[model samples]
Target: MVEIDPADNTAPPAGGKRFAPLWEPPPAPTRGRPARVNRTQIVDAAVAIADERGLDAVSMRSVARALGVGTMTLYSHVPSRDHLIDAMIDRAYADFALPDPDLPWRTALETYARGYFSLLRSHSWLLTVNTWRMPLAPHVFDADEAAFRILVDTGLTANQVVETIGIVRQAVSGFARAAAAEIADERDQGTDYEAYWSAQTDFWENTFDPARYPTMTRLWTMGAFDDAATPFDLRIGALLDTIELLIERAGGSGTAVPSFDECVRMSGPDPAGCADVDTADA
Candidate 1:
């Protein structure tokens, strides 16, 4: 984990510094004693529990056990369970590669949206975290700043930039949440989707009256549910297309943004393409 100085007085232009330095490392141990642990280790342990068992399993006691320390010792580093959760959320966001600024606004947004969806899917418990209750952490702020920076320079007003990013973020999160639910359902059933749905064929044929539900019968016959990815792919593509239209209506050329490949090359050696772009201006 990166250490930031909590005492630093510098503030970003956006709204007088609403978040504290939650990722800062703990004070070093005194002489003759080994350093017990750091905030990063605690957050990592908590996140591991959440990823393996689920969010509800991530109590301070559980994390302390995982770290081979007493539960009270965790408080000295994280303050509380809520603060530990905030750190976990921030750590997840930090995993994201910041959007390449040189890419066109659309490409950059697409890349970010896909990455966000992937993260949520991988860590399904993340969807359960109440983001509204937690102060913005550095990694979360970095994502927002990168998205805003890309869209802000494209002739959109500040409000428009904010709204646009909100739309994209909501779409990605919503889709990922639904996908996670579907995955959980399958796991609980101990069967794949096709096998489970096939077992319900008798119910559809007998209970679902064909005369009253013509479209339903047609869809069942066509095996529409067999390919879950089609609907998700189509919806995401349509959403991106609509956003492009909105940009054009605002008198901005949708093609003006650079390609993802170009941004990668510009970032040389680092595939994440997160070179020092001014996030504060966003």
Candidate 2:
């Protein structure tokens, strides 16, 4: 079962006015018996269903059954399926731990990326949702705020700040999505990424034309195929290096900031282990 979000915010969300009803729930029914559950409870139940089975299994009827309430009873709380999903996505995002304001900018992003990637893995069903249509819910905006806050004080301009955050977030999103899709599909497919790829071993070892793919052939010969996965920080640290160059180009302190390796090493983990960040404490 999924843990329920403890946020009791009652203020209207700042991003989307039409989504206000979800943020500001309906007043308790004054004419009839009060609702058996509030909107949060309904959303929590639906999230549970989605987590266990998948998003496709989370409909009004399925959630109603999980909550031990009738289908119409859910309608009173969640006006529609669209409303429920928008709430669900935000609820999952609420699990993200925002960076502490006192930390250095690179450290803050490290904290944010690790936490966000774990959240995506936990709720991999989120990958299937049409996120383009997802409402600009409170937590979503808060996440965007956390990213902006990290870079706002840098000498980079507004456009640079936005692009930098977009790039970092997309990196986390794309990598985690590739990793999660393999795990989630194992439910019905009965084979994971490693197992599925092993099927092509014979062709790769014998039939493949190494002359046509020189670099890949070299990598394969070096036992690089022994573990095809690239470590996360190797890529992210390189990104940080580029961003540092950008900061220097903008007349800000670039090399003054500790490298990802330096900060991470000071924080007491093996540098390579940064890729396996367990952000429960984030």
Candidate 3:
């Protein structure tokens, strides 16, 4: 559900010009034929399907079914699947509470990231959706705008701000994809990440060569595989530190950002947990 950037919106979208249909009030409509279906309902239906069965399960038809409306009636609200997907993507952002305008760049950005990640986790479909597409919906734009402002406040040029946003967004995307894959596989097995990782640790302990991987061996010895540490914040904090360095390097004023490697490698959960998780490309 990539969107066109409003800032770069140059002309009508790649469709032949079509006239807006004339509007007519229904003659004293009864409760049977509702005059309107709120946009929130459409988005809520989409979100419900995404949360329950993942994004692919979300279709206009499914949404209509969820809404107890005729499929054709859905078109009156969401003109196309693409359009519906657009709304769905933006609607997820609406769940994110944007940063306080008065907060420092770092605190605001961190808050934004937390909220964004929360939404991604809550709406797993977002993990599969493309982020490069420009956002058109007001809520999506508002979030991006909030991020851009933080970057600018950090003293980054507009170009730098844009690039930084792309980088951080990729970090979020990477984590979300990882989460989605983990959840998808777990759902099929009726288990969770911790359980799957525990199984992985048992397998690795049996097969991994201590001679070939000394670091892994030491980590294993340290009970890194056991319920000793949750690495989520450690990794996220490391990424923030890396980004802070990048910011300092660019200039004293701009926000720093992290590469996917910095985010994943530093913030990555224990290797023992993902030991059973397939690393091979699917």
Write down the TM-score of every candidate: 0.73, 0.73, 0.69
lDDT of 1: 0.70
RMSD of 1: 9.4
- Sorted by lDDT, highest first, which candidate order results? 2, 1, 3
Top model number, lDDT:
2
TM-score of 1: 0.73
**Lowest-sum lDDT 10-residue window in model 2:** 2-11
Taking the tens digit of each residue's C-alpha lDDT, what string does model 1 give over 191-224? 8655776799789757878889888778877987
lDDT score of residue 131 within candidate 2? 52
lDDT, model 2: 0.74
Tally clashes: model 3.
Answer: 6
Pairs in steric clash, model 2 = none
Query: How do the residues 76-191 of candidate 3 rate in per-residue lDDT, one tens digit apiece?
Result: 65556666666777778788888898998778878878777777778877777776664466677788878887766464544777887777777776676676677667769887
Best by TM-score: 2
The stretch of ten residues in a row with the least summed lDDT in candidate 1 is 1-10
